[model samples]
Target: MNTTPTIDVPVQVLSGPTVLIEYAGLRILTDPTFDEPGEYPVMPGYAMTKTSGSPLGTDEVGRIDAVLLSHDEHDDNLDRSGRAFLPRVPVVFTTISGAGRLGGNAKGLAFWDEATLTAPDGTVVTVTGLPARHGPEGSEPVSGDVVGFLLTAPGHPSVYVSGDNASLDYVQQIADRCAPIDTAILFIGGVRHKPMLDAQLVTIDNTQATWIARALQARRVIPAHFEGWAHFQGTREDLTRTFEEAGLADRLTYA
Candidate 1:
């Protein structure tokens, strides 16, 4: 019997854009929003009071090695419950302003700074923070500081977690910093509602996501930030068809 080796890189979709990546036995939670009833609101599109997806209570998740905040403004990425659980964990990595906001709860990692987060097997993993553009181009007032992460494991596949962003230039920049990427999780949602059809308002719709994924030359492209809210317009089917049409079906991987 040919036994297939189990790829231990486990990824659990907690909610909307939130995910738990268990790589090398290290449990890393990205953009955790575990609020019940999903009360926190982000932008005009996304909000959560919890009870949206899997019920991941604090006890159920066990211990988390590190928490990646990316940017602290969005509720989808940051929630009250997640914020409350900050001091409980050993290390919390995010922006300086966000940490200050936490009030002794967690520490902040400056943008582009690299830190070693211990793995489950005692091996150290390197996490690099990359820049991200939130909201529209040339519109910094409404848009906040969004960041991405490069999770690197020596001799293993490295992953890029694209927080809520849509700019192709930002995607290209991430690729420039970390080329030959093994995997990339792009936040793909065409989030559109009444009276807001302008390109400046909506982030990575189907077209933009496809372009960025292809530009990154990622071995595997995973789509996130959809299906858990009513405001998010993009769907898995939309991604599937787009990738297929772009001739990147082989490269695209849907969660």
Candidate 2:
């Protein structure tokens, strides 16, 4: 058996846009929304369906190390059941607004703040917060501060987890200022109300993910948040096609 202590990351699609990331022998849950199954129309009224994607039963997941929640939307991220499991875990990293929403049990951290946490084998895992946006175009005052994360293992290539982003500008900026990224786990679904709107409806979609992969020149790209929700419309097929069409099929991998 290969006994190298490397970060082998895997993305498990729970339900619309909700992803479970397994890395470094630890589980990281993102936007854990176990909404009642069915189709729900997007408030502000964009799409059809009250909800979709079967709810990942409480016992469905295992070993949740940390949570990289972007916002405090119940539909997109964080459900009642998910929150109940928070206090059981040692650390829960999320946005300030979400911290409040997560109640006093979970500690809050700012975007770009790097915190070191212990892994299963006592390995020091460095978690760095990366900036993210809810919607595309300009930032609205109403939305909360949503951010991604950069995890660096001692003997492994660094991994970047994009929570929910609509723009590649922030990704490019992160790639430029910080150290080089080896594997980037992007939330790709391109779930939008219209073709011309932003993609953070759940993920950055195909076009933006492509832009980021090229900009950062990352080695491996894992797509998430594409095939889980009722509101989410983008698919892994869409991302694959876009990357292939863009001549980036080899670089972008679907997890």
Candidate 3:
């Protein structure tokens, strides 16, 4: 269960990494993986199994102004169904390599680069790409390049979206550059695959999520990408318990 909106902005976690962040009348989506429970061969020997599907389909999630895809290499981030839905969005923001692969309405954002989106009434929203490490240090070659996102508008609370990032150092870096965040959408699952990087934390774990809140000095926190897949080792209860034990439960919310 979630308490009332702390920032008054609607942040909904649909499933997996898929989230709808409505800011200043602009709808922004993150890592759209809408496929039903199934199996995907991530590596030759490693397979990912989705235990549940999204409650809302693409049609139901109407009017997305942009998609902040962390990366396109992983199935958990962008599945078949999600790939098909990208064209409908006005713009899809992702890594440079992903933009070339996705093409058509997909624009790439390098680290610290800013992209803008306009609403029907000409309200502008700024989206900035942030550095994201998918696994332990020096794991980029195997983990591939991932990116987090930061959104800002004139009066709306700033939102930081951590996309499959595992490093607290990177979070600290973001804090130094853009601290006092109003809302943070953390992707935390403690995901692990024995075949990859000696099985390290692929994303922020429950405890780490709490640290992220502190690092960013965030007023409100919403978690995503923590469940619905076999590789996810953390549970919602674990996340809630972690925050509660840390005396930060008032900052946690679910949609």
Candidate 4:
């Protein structure tokens, strides 16, 4: 048996879906949204309200080696300031459609597609795109395309970042393909938009997050996108309660 030291990666949740992941001497930012709390119009009457500002500002974030953007169409994921910040990053990995829409250092990957990036210490990190759905089965037409991400390195534990998925079936598929995920960063908000689809959830809720943790058998579960927005129906307390009830509270991590 080959024994290698496991590299511990540090994940810091700034706000909402924006997180700073430090691994292999590299800083990776996810779904950068630094705009102040305000109302962002999505459709004619539909608007997404931001309730909180990111703890860290773009200037404080310093240099970002790469970005793992699930999708860019929504302001909650990538706000006005985030769009402006993308051009500065060295590389950005997002959905194929989003890439096409956003050129310039932006690369798109289909589900299961992989990309390799070299860290400052010459460590090669393999990032693979995973499947995700923003809404119900037939909601893609209006919901657009979203993608999750998986990170793997030689000595680092594998990490899964679920962007905006709502379906448990998709989670099952991910579990079957990539079981025993060491760290799982799930986007939970239970977002609802009545004008769009009768207030159906646009992302996973607390119960689903608990199920996802059990399915993946994740060593660490960090929930994001559960707060800082008006549309989100779920909260960190809800997730904590669910995980506690499931006897998996030890696995939950706020940062």
For model 1, the superposed segments whose C-alpha errors exceed 4 Å read: 1-8, 38-51, 192-202
Encode model 1's per-residue lDDT on 1-255: one tens digit a residue: 011122335677777777788766788888777766545554476443333754587668887878877767767677767767767777777776667777564666665888887776777788887777666676545656677788876655777888877667777877676776767777777764333335454357877777877677677777777667666775678778888998888877655
Cα-based TM-score, every candidate: 0.85, 0.82, 0.96, 0.96
**Candidate 1 weakest ten by summed lDDT:** 1-10
Error of 4 at 171 (Å): 1.3
True lDDT of residue 36, candidate 3 = 90
Q: Judging by lDDT, tell me the better candidate of 1 and 2.
A: 1
Off by more than 4 A, model 4: 1-7
Q: Rate the local accuracy (lDDT) of all candidates.
A: 0.70, 0.68, 0.89, 0.89
lDDT of 4 by residue, 60-165 (tens): 9988999999999999999999999999999999999999999999999999999999998899999999999999889988999999999888778888899988
TM-score of candidate 2 to 2 decimals: 0.82
Selected candidate, larger lDDT, 2 vs 3? 3
- Tell me the tens digit of each residue's lDDT in model 2 across 97-186: 778867765556677788877778877878888888866656545344677888776765677778777766777778786545677778
Candidate 2 Cα errors over 4 Å, as ranges: 1-7, 39-56, 193-203
Lowest summed-lDDT stretch of 10 residues in model 2? 1-10
Better by lDDT, candidate 4 or 2: 4
